[model samples]
Target: MRYLYSLLLLCSIVLWSSCRNDFETEPSTGNLQFSRDTVYLDTVFSNIGSSTYNLKVYNRSDDDITIPTIQLAGGESSNYRLNVDGLPGKSFENIDILAKDSIFVFIETTANIENFSNENQFLLTDAIEFDTGANQQKVELVTLIQDAVFLYPEKFDDGTTESLSFGFDEEGNEILIEGFFLDETELTFTNEKPYVIYGYAAVPGNRTLNIEAGARVHFHEASGIIVAQDGSLHVNGMLSNDQETLENEVIFESDRLEPDFSEIPGQWGAIWLTAGSTNNLINYATIKNATVGILTESNDGTSNPTLTINNSKIYNSSNAGLLARTGHVKGNNLVIGSAGQSSLSLSLGGQYNFTNCTFANYWTGSYRSLPTVLVQNYLETPEQIFVSDLIEANFNNCIIYGNENRELVLNERSEADFNARFENCLIRYNDFGFGSQGYDFDDETLFPGTIINVIPNFYNPQENEFMIDEESGANNLANPSTATNQDILGTPRGSSPDSGAYESIIFPEED
Candidate 1:
């Protein structure tokens, strides 16, 4: 008897739920409200997918409302894609919203910039139509697309992606890397449109890749530019007059344009200069958000400088801003903001020189264990360690500081010729490693006018602004003999110039 009674009660509950599920909704009135009348998606590259954006539809009436028809104005042929509520479709029918409740509509787009009229940026327009007849309503959708020259490896008929030959592996088998060599005609990048590169843009041997001023270069994940053996990379960037807008400066960064990725690091690989790639120059440029901002291997067995970068900025690298391995590099008025390992890493005994440069690493993304400037005369491998000649690692009127206690680290192999000198520079070192490395603070021969553990008094290192304050310890610390005449901003560095990339400037007080 008890079992029968329980079964009857369960049946009654099931019937009630079935009836509740069959509840009806009234047709939506013309007076429906929306969270926003228009949804503007962020800009995207031509043929690239845009970030997902959402819109809300409100049903404010007492009764549950049913939208008779919800579809895009361009219909099935529209570039925009819609996902109404939880159902994905080009057009949806009988979309119901509970009383005083809302439903979300997600939008995404993949469009060709050529399809849209190019007025400044290629503007794409579409509308989400709700209901029909006199009760029709619309929620506008817009997207801005920029035309870009996309460079990627050609796909074969198979599902596998094409790859380039990168020599052989230990097993005597050929190793293929994901990249393609740029042809002679495609070597030069003009300022007409931005370049979107997938995989590595490998410059062939003895070839030269020129990037014009005002040109923007974006790389996809694990992608970068590789100057082959005996190749040259000439980035011809010009200094802009307005400090706010570095209009003529060339920018090399990740392809992601979303706000979340603006400050994130390690989005792409490095601008790699392979062994024997000589005569590389980058001026008035910004290179950011890479595994390594600039990776230099062994230089051409010559006295010529491998790379000469001036008036440039490199920041947000996961590894190192300047990673040189047995290479020779020179820089003037250069600024490296932050990195996971070292802002300026000279490993395997490299010849590096920096004049009036700022290497500040305030990396908070991870618990950083390395210093801002790490100089090593030896390279560790699985089999054995290799020690080479450093010759010179010089810094003049530069600032090497970071969140770490010792921003300057020297891990040397005594057998190698590790000669380093700092002249009129500010370095943050509170540890005793310098003493153990056979160095003296009072040694005028190696450390002349070099301030130790003194605060740069940066306006804000967290925001990558190294502009010093009036009471900065770095102010007037630079030796007049070694200081550059002009800062990175083309600002005149008077005879008594301050240290770092920028000379101390008086900013107007905020009202």
Candidate 2:
């Protein structure tokens, strides 16, 4: 009788389980859907301030959702919390969210997103719940991905250690750059390879460079380097020309789209050599597309290192050709353009020595400040009117030319010492009276012994835009005694040299 009772109990249990499975009911509900799949928040914030962003949430479910109360997941204060309660956070009151409704969620952070850590995850308040039948409940959302961070290039403290492998993107571009930094370390780019930058690049702090020779670099209209004060650059490599590469090479790397000249203006920033740097050298390279070109400033009133440029080309910039605050610079083949602003203007404190250089202003209209060897450099526009002061300096074996024969005016009060000279150089000007002022003579004055009859260089003058007509006084000033002080490479205008940037280079006459 006991065995029979056990068997009956087992059968009863199995029968009840089968009946429950067959009679179970399914909940009637719609699939959950979000109003938008992605949200983008783009902003530029400094490290001194805080900002907030909001995300909206919508529910497409058929049942109602209840949110008791919203609060930060962690026990952190409201300063870093996304969801805040009206009063204290201990409230357990549930909020009934209707169908197809939306609610906004907030995310707050201190000034500068860089303060946030990588491990922190965004969380919503769970003080609310939803009934099974609630339709289209809404919730505010936050992004799971973090912001981009900057990583600087590695260098040794004592110039003995090797840098760790720096990572690059798929296109082989460097990532994570601090726009400004201050360090004494020197980074070397040794491989004699060509590098193309597709994005922005910067060297913010003081940097020492040991770049190898024959290294080709391209600053894709998007890249530039700015070195802050107390930082100096030593470039031993060559910067290749984009025009040369596009014309001769045929390499397929990525999308082959034509360059959009209109999209990028002053496509790249100038190489800013801040006030503290010294002893910078630029040799054998072509630098282009910069607005201000190469600028050096010494605000603290200390004469630092000398900027030496030998056998190089500086051309095609949009602003004042070369800007120098205070330094001793030696330039050769130093082609400066007055196309945008005045070409090669120096601040009141700058000291310059130029040689075998070309200063070309190939425009017709009058620029506010004509390019002059001045002690100061200022910003200019097409509508402004001004003449720069020709302060103390030497222009030897150099070419000075402007468009439509417009001459570079030398202000009456400015001083040009005897050492300041222009030799064997052409000075072309649009206004005949103003062009010969640099020679301390006029077009009507002429010497039979020094005169050489030649047609006016209406097209391209030998040097820059300034030229000499046979009957003009410029003829007698052709070979001045000032030319003697210049070096073989034409520099350091000695005592009583002519007033321009060229020393005679005796070349064999062509057959």
Candidate 3:
């Protein structure tokens, strides 16, 4: 058949010349071996975008090279941004790299700082380079940026978009909200720089906001801080008098400055306070991760306490670290910790008063079905059935522990009014199930001088560290004049007081 078609065209030309001699055009004499000549990319926040940073590039010699130029020394007017191996670049060519193989690059940044004018942080640099065959390499990158106070949400022209306004709707009608109201000169927030929000920032009814004291805010992703109704939000974080320094506190988190997002729980939203917002304070401050760290709502029976936390610390909340629907809150040296549901939820009920607080919840990030203080009153939807009136839910010298086994929960609801109280507290709850509709740590008149299922040696409930171990059983049980004679780091508290917000201070074991 014509000599088998010339032996199938000479075996397809010897398999395309043995696949072009198994690739390897040589041409690189640079000896490239980087995995980090200078990546840094840390602080970010002027125009935001960051967090990719990689590098690799090894090819430890065995031939196959070719890199003639990979560069971005500010190439396309760079503000940093590259990709390289998967191409998306500021410049690249030849590339290839086989024999001892390795090649990644990544890097990212956003930085705009309105042409940066020398102030609240601003470094940003760049380099990359590489060119081969005649040698030339480099890497460096750096970052820093900062310059915040962003806030967002405002897009009128009929396309509608202002944000932050859940105002009226319990039959008082008038509801049509959706944010945007600040004005009182943007409401305060000072401590020199970092703010960043990006959506719900409301506060308008009678306006208040404040913030100051080393402020740092952040937010983003589902942002927060509402307030409205009669509005007010204070925050003042103050301590410095040898309290070993939380500098000046005030740090609401999550704009993700990445360390794998620190303790990453809900990453933002909540700090609401709504229902006719009243006094609202929040001293020393810390409020972390979010999605409910201070919700509030319900108050209208005002007696001057609609919120008044002090020496604050709400931690990684994925739901409630102090929610209080029928609100009236009033903490003191508080501490709240990890919570995928309740670390103090007092739902649909009002008037709560913690003191030397510390509600701990060893939530290892997932599967935490409630409890760490819940006390409810009523809430059945399907179109109406609300009920509220928890009239007074106290908890002096508190320490309600958690890691479940019933860490306190009382959902009452036979037509409202659940009135609570648990003095000299330390309850880790073992459900002493009392009649008339639940709750009874052996009812010593509703848990007076309460201690129940004890074990508050804390000092590190898996690191949320609710400081207390001096062979704690909440040592000296508290009530030295209703606790708080210092603690929350200001130390003192001695004539027999140590219960929760820290006051065990011994130190001295460091051979």
lDDT of 3 by residue, 16-124 (tens): 8888767757978888899888989888788889889889999898888988889888899889989899988789999988879889989898977779666888898
How do these models rank on lDDT, best leading? 1, 3, 2
lDDT comparing candidate 1 with the true structure: 0.90
Clashing pairs in 3: 163-178, 163-179, 163-180, 164-178, 164-179, 165-179
Question: What are the clash counts of all predictions, listed in order?
Answer: 0, 69, 6
Q: What lDDT score belongs to each candidate, Candidate 1 first?
A: 0.90, 0.44, 0.82
Better of 2 and 3 by TM-score: 2
RMSD of each: 2.5, 20.7, 22.6
Off by over 4 Å in 2: 1-178, 182-186, 195-207, 220-223, 237-265, 299-305, 363-369, 372-391, 411-424, 430-439, 442-511
RMSD of 3: 22.6
Candidate 2, residues 271-359: lDDT per residue as tens digits?
66666665677765445556666777653344534577654544445665577754457675555644466566665334566655656
Q: Can you tell me which runs of candidate 3 are displaced by over 4 Å?
A: 1-25, 28-49, 55-68, 73-77, 81-98, 103-106, 113-183, 187-253, 257-263, 266-288, 295-320, 323-343, 347-363, 366-373, 376-511
- For candidate 2, the C-alpha RMSD (Å) to the true structure equals 20.7
Candidate 2, residue 273: the lDDT equals 66
Best by TM-score: 1
Leading candidate by lDDT = 1
RMSD of 1: 2.5
